[model samples]
Target chain A: MINYKTVNDNKCLVIEISEDFIIDNSDNIKLKDAINKIESLPEIAEIDFDTTALKSWDSSILTFLNHIKSHCLKHNIAFIKDSLPGGVQRLIALAEAVPERKGVRKTEVNRSYLASSVAAIGEKVVNFTKTSKDMLAFLGETTIAFARLITGRYKIRGSILMPIIRECSVDALPIVSLISCLVGLILAFVGAVQLVIFGAQIYVASLVGIAMIRVMGAVMAGVIMAGRTGAAFAAQLGTMEVNEEIDALKTLGISPVEFLVLPRVLALSIIMPLLCVYADLMGILGGMIVGVFMLDLNVMEYYNMTRDSVSLNSFWIGIFQSFVFGILVALAGCLRGMQCKRSASAVGEAATAAVVTGIVAIVVATAVITVLCNVMGI
Target chain B: MLWGFKHLDIKTASITLKNLTEREIGDIKVPPDLTVKNLPDSMKTPHIIVKNITMAYGDLVIQQNLDFTVNKGDIFIIMGGSGCGKSTLLRHLVGLQKPAKGDIIYNVLSKNSDLEQNRQKEINFWNTSAEEQRLLMKNFGILYQSGALWSSMTLAENIALPLEAYTDLSSSQIMELASLKLALVGLAGFEGYYPSEISGGMRKRAGLARAMALDPDFLFFDEPSAGLDPVSARLLDDLILELRQSFGSTIVVVTHELASMFAIGTNSVFLDPVTKTMIAHGDPKYLLESSKDERVINFLTRGEGKQIV
Candidate 1:
């Protein structure tokens, strides 16, 4: 364990960090508090992070030091870590990158953070593609396995289908419907707010009809499923992968794709359409809520406008897009699971990757389809 | 250890699968032609020769220049450190992974060749179809370290999974066979239970039952004793030895458990951590007692008191 303590000398304030700082979170907190105190005191000029008393410290304490540096920069106070250990120098350098007294705006900070996250996501996607060949093979093999499963041969009348429906489909409906309804209400309300300024409040019904049928329903369904079902699938398969059950299947000549991936892919592919249908209905219902209660528009008037605006082709296109999104989400989840490293942490990471990748795929697909339809004058 | 004991009663927490009667277990009597002890004598031409096979992930070389032969019916055990490529070697054997640099040649015998060729053909029939390969593997079973039973399936369903996939048996017949397997693994009455509902040891047993479902000729185990307490591990080790004696199947085990190594490995291969090479290969007792190799000596005699690196 490392400990750190700061002493106020006549010329300089000395901060002593105990070696047990690595094991002690309180030490870090105290260090931060001390830094905060020194920064607040106008008399203090140079602050020395006294690592002579330091025994051990993890990278986390370095981050806390970074916090201190930031605080010092805020106050135009110079922070010195001359006694800092070699291990924490890099962190200090990184934290010290920002100059003193030139703070970023909140929006700029958010955008920079967003940009870094996006870059990280891009790197992950590239990395995923490297391992994707094996995953593709696994998926192909799993597809074959699923086809075999559906041959009506492995019927023990066992409780397989119920779990699929309960866990993957039926259980997901209420939440899916609820989220879709909320999204619809928000969209309609936003449209109403904008159109009422132009004396076109009634056009909000048409906007809701077009958006729900073409974009919102499928996109929202895909995003939610990516968050919910996609994560579940990855977690399930990842747990199996970590447990070596997949290897057991391989050794038994039982293809994991057939045994594990197939069922999940099939379940997701089948359940996705249902989810989309539910989403579309609920979104329209939400629109109806806004139309009647919020927008002061009658329910029948809203329905008639929706009916006029939404064609069978429009509805079908949305449904078809959702179906594609479902497959992509399922594939992304399964791929992540298949690519999962043989560890518990790997499983968790794979599950998170599944959801993230699924949402990205959804956004890209939705954008492409929307653009394509606009170009074709649909 | 107390936590292990506390988990013993977990089997009764959920729905249990039906067990098969003693008479219903499928009888498979196959001779064990592949014992590691008889590798030099039995292998006229090595089926799979691993010579100086070096494998690494990034900067760390898991195994290097490994020299070994896997012949028909050879129950080979590869023992090493945690990340020492024991599992990687098994993956190579199963053709799931290619070595970093090594040749794995498979001898194909054609039917139209001469008399000697005919004999070779008789010894080895070639089939390219995946289904055919699967059918051949039907005679093999694999028990994983973590006892990878399917979470969704009941114990009975898990055991019966292979039969359903490859066989034409009715549900009743599959259940009966599955029960027999369950009984063999001491999971007779717990067939309907899901993997989540069962204890770890029971799940391992269940995995073993499922592995044996196809009546495989070769059985592969990866860290069979991992994550288990001494008592459960001992029970599992005993079970492994009993199966080896009774079934006479080719058992390839990848484990570093010294107790398990000494107990069941008739012949074993010692994988060195530093060299990433096979330091010794022979009977465990002989290698431990007679080998002058420092690594081998240190590895074999190192008691459980020393923590594994």
Candidate 2:
């Protein structure tokens, strides 16, 4: 066991610890409790340990000595270890050899809500600035890549581009068509309520046609593609980053943007308008279905009204919006992928961030384009 | 588990119900570590026996009819050119892969399980129960090539995880032991740093610290110097030597790094792809000086061993 003596009102506390200070023995229990008790007393100005009897100790004696050392360091108590074995002394010295490095530990202390909020806002502003700079740099690189493509200097492997094109276009068609169709149907139904009150049920077709052709079809498709294709792109490139393939490309003197990003972006941009036209067709059909079945309008009449109401100008506007959104989604996904850290979980985080960024870019582009469309009298 | 196990019939031995305490096991005198080239001594004292092992995938035999012995406290190297089933053999040794034909036996000298009586009946690789496997595993510690430290935890936390899972130590005690292990690996002040924050060499050392956390008797290193610089690799070699000196734990390293192979290796097995079995088996240094196989010579000397000097 363990023996302790209190001299001069605990100013000089002597702890004598002995043989086989293992956890299995009942000695560890008493020593553990005594160590904690001795450690807490502020009045104990000095601590001395006797460990010559520690014939075979595992973590128990080490734990006890560590406590005594740290307690002495904390309370400015003089720790005398002349009575301890050389090996135990050396072990203690080894464990305490390096004082903890400064600022390595993440310290979190309670702070006022206002203070924390201000700090958070400041951090957000810094992060926003950094992201803006990164986006601009990415755009510059993309512009250079596009210039190289126009000059026919950049290599575009048909194999890589073809699959991406199919995924972003053919693979995305069903969901995009379904969401756009539902959007058109909802628009028709809501417009029918007001149009019916005014005895102008035919104008409901114009409302559905204009809304779906101008913005609804493109926006719905944009959201769908952002969640589907953009996230896939990010995950793919993020995995490439993890495997150091992107670095390998750079080492081989081929720009990752020119080799990997350009093909994907170009494919998305090319297929986007085509998909929008398809979305527009699907949306008009959905509206036609809703009108003929729910509004007692004849199918031929509904078809004629839709054909008359939707202008080529509105269709072109929707196509242009979709093209821009496709570019933004590709850019957002690629940028996030390039920014991915070299770790397995970073790939997943990059994919999630890509989806968020893609949708945000689409929404923000929609707002800007809508204003520009209005001003330009599109 | 203690080490001097006697084989009765080389087949099976009944588990004796003697309650052998840790103190009693510790009192058993371990045979002094001698030169591994002593055949009779080593044959009688095989710490781990790879008996008639045949590693395969489907119909493809990676290596067949492989047999080897690793003695106690030996720094054993499993050396081969890339893709010669060296790692496959290591996987079999560590209980990760099942041998298509044979079983690996660890002759843990434990009295309670009557482990010594039947030549490793307690931990008969594929035949033993899951609990028996876990018990056998407690005596082992493996360090992967990538230093596979948990990315999320701090260095100290990663080291403390095994301690927390297996031991009854308090939080403060665990932290202290973690620091101790880290200090042992020359990573004293890096307790709070994440694996990502440290250099690749430091990460490997931290992994070593974690492996040594349970104070395991069998320590394994897989390509420990695969990605390390020369200085760091040499430092790792020194660390391995020190670990053997201090703890005297049996070390099994899987590497083809020649400098490391000749430096710390007390015994080694050379796996050849063409032969699809061990071409050479003996002490690495002894094989380097005496072995006559051309392939083995080419491998040992980094070129043609016969031609070089």
Candidate 3:
């Protein structure tokens, strides 16, 4: 319990803290009330602690005392703690021994909602312009690195290239296969449901084939690689930056773009189309499984229909989209990583940003290619 | 056949007896007429022996043929010119970077243990398995130049992390120990603050608190005073000396501060960037007074033209 009474003709306020003044007790309201009473008294010249009845205490009691101490300091009231226990006095002394460091606390500002919104929008616009400029700079650097690689100037070691190739291509197979096959199966089943009613169930093969070959397969692979390899590249490069390994490479006159980014870009670009083709085959096979078992169509008949429905133009477009997606994912990941601040948390933010950027780029590229294909009658 | 066996003190005799059981007394070879009076009052125990380590980063040799010994309970300073691989050598000693050639041997025997146990207990740091290396690393407390605290955790949580991982103490007990460690570094009430919330000097002190969390035997500090003002830097030097006096921990500090070197360093190795090797090794004060190497004198006096007398 906490109780306070004014003495010396209301000139001094004495606070009494008694039994079980620990953190567990719900006596905060009492403390707050006492503080309010002390604040209201204008003529009070001093505040004192009367702890003769105090039996037990902890950090909670210290915190309570600290609140009053701050209030007394603010009001220039003399704080007398002579009645408190020796241990409590010493703890209070220890806590105040190192003064609260100047300019360490973050200053909070209150602003109108409209003003805050305008400020936020201004910050976003500035950030967007900065990000765009950085992206263009990274793009130019990558182009130069590519030119050097083509002209027999920059040689990428097999040690670095091989691991990245394996990571984005071979290691990505299981997830890509699963997602593409599921997309094909869902397409086949949904088509079969409607075609069955119209007595055209065999059309499910063509429906699944055209969709998978033209876009679904590559899209699924792109999303999977974005989440897997893109995030990984960001995390790897971001950690290298944090460890000053990238700076070390720079100090040695080796361009990080050429040594680090080029290998990753080459690996991802070369593997994405191959993975996309493999994903197309897996998706067609998944469609066949549905057509043969679920729709009772002959396996060879379904395969022949798929071959007929998937045009060369659609297949080439899908490959091209996947290649572009690969380059985009790699660039996005590396760009975010290179831009990362030297902190542990920044690595995580970079990885997340890489995934988001990769996925968004894939979807936008898909949209533009679709519109172009329609306009050109592909 | 045991020449000094008769004059061996009780402690030394017991150690000799312990070794005698391991090896035949006839196999024990003692120097002629070696007596307690002639023997060293206390032998310097080699805690770490760097044997001809050549540090390199892919074809670029930073330092070569580097050999030194860090003795037990010694504040060993690794001082050199900027970019002379002083921090690199500390990294090698702490097992962060591998040496291009030779080995780093750690003597695992306690300071007061028998001298005969040195060879038997010696461990090749690089040759150990990953698990063994991790166990060895547990005894080391490293303070990086940037005070690399886990930015996400509060000072108390950062100090409590190793305790939580390696000990079975309750949460409250760990927190209390964390507070105690913070208090030792004069950051008593700043336990709830994050690393970014404090000043640079405070962050360094907090880093020291985290380093001492497990009460490690070896404390390695990289640039303990690089970013601090003179007053805080001096206070830190005093804190380091106090830590050594109280805990008797072997300290390896990578610093170029002449004041710090003379103030606390018991022994040191002067690394030469030009030669890519150490040019001098001994007590820093003694080296300052007696070393004939011009580079050593130039470095020790901060190139202010104080030649050896």
List iRMS for all predictions.
Answer: 2.0, 16.0, 10.9
Going through the candidates in order, their DockQ values are 0.40, 0.01, 0.02
Candidate 3 positional error at A159, Å: 1.4
Better of 1 and 2 by DockQ: 1
TM-scores of the models, in the given order? 0.69, 0.51, 0.58
Which candidate has the top score in DockQ?
1
- Candidate 1's residue-wise lDDT over B259-305, tens digit each? 78887776678777656777777667666766667666677767422
Model 1 residue A135 CA deviation (Å) reads 6.9
Model 2 TM-score, all chains together:
0.51
Decreasing DockQ order of the candidates: 1, 3, 2
lDDT of 2 by residue, B1-309 (tens): 123244443222332322232233334343332222554542234567777789998798999877777767889999888989887787678776689998787867443444454333225768888656656776777787777676546999878866765678998999999999999999999999998899988989998998899887788888999999999999999999999889878899999899998899988888899789887887888887778788888898887567673
How good is the docking of model 2, as DockQ?
0.01
Cα error, residue B301 of model 3, in Å, equals 18
Score residue B99 of candidate 3 by CA lDDT.
Answer: 99
Error of 3 at B227 (Å): 18
Summarize candidate 1's per-residue lDDT along A1-378 as a digit string, tens digits: 323334564335666666476645476667657766675566776677667767777877776777777777887767787678877887777766976554444444445878989988998999887667776776677666656667964332335555765686788888888999999999899998899889887888888888888888888888988999899889988988887777767756766665566666667777777778788889989988988997788888989988998888888889889888978888889888888998889989999999999999999998898899889988
Highest-scoring model, lDDT:
3
Scored by lDDT, model 3 comes in at 0.83
- 1 or 2, greater by lDDT: 2
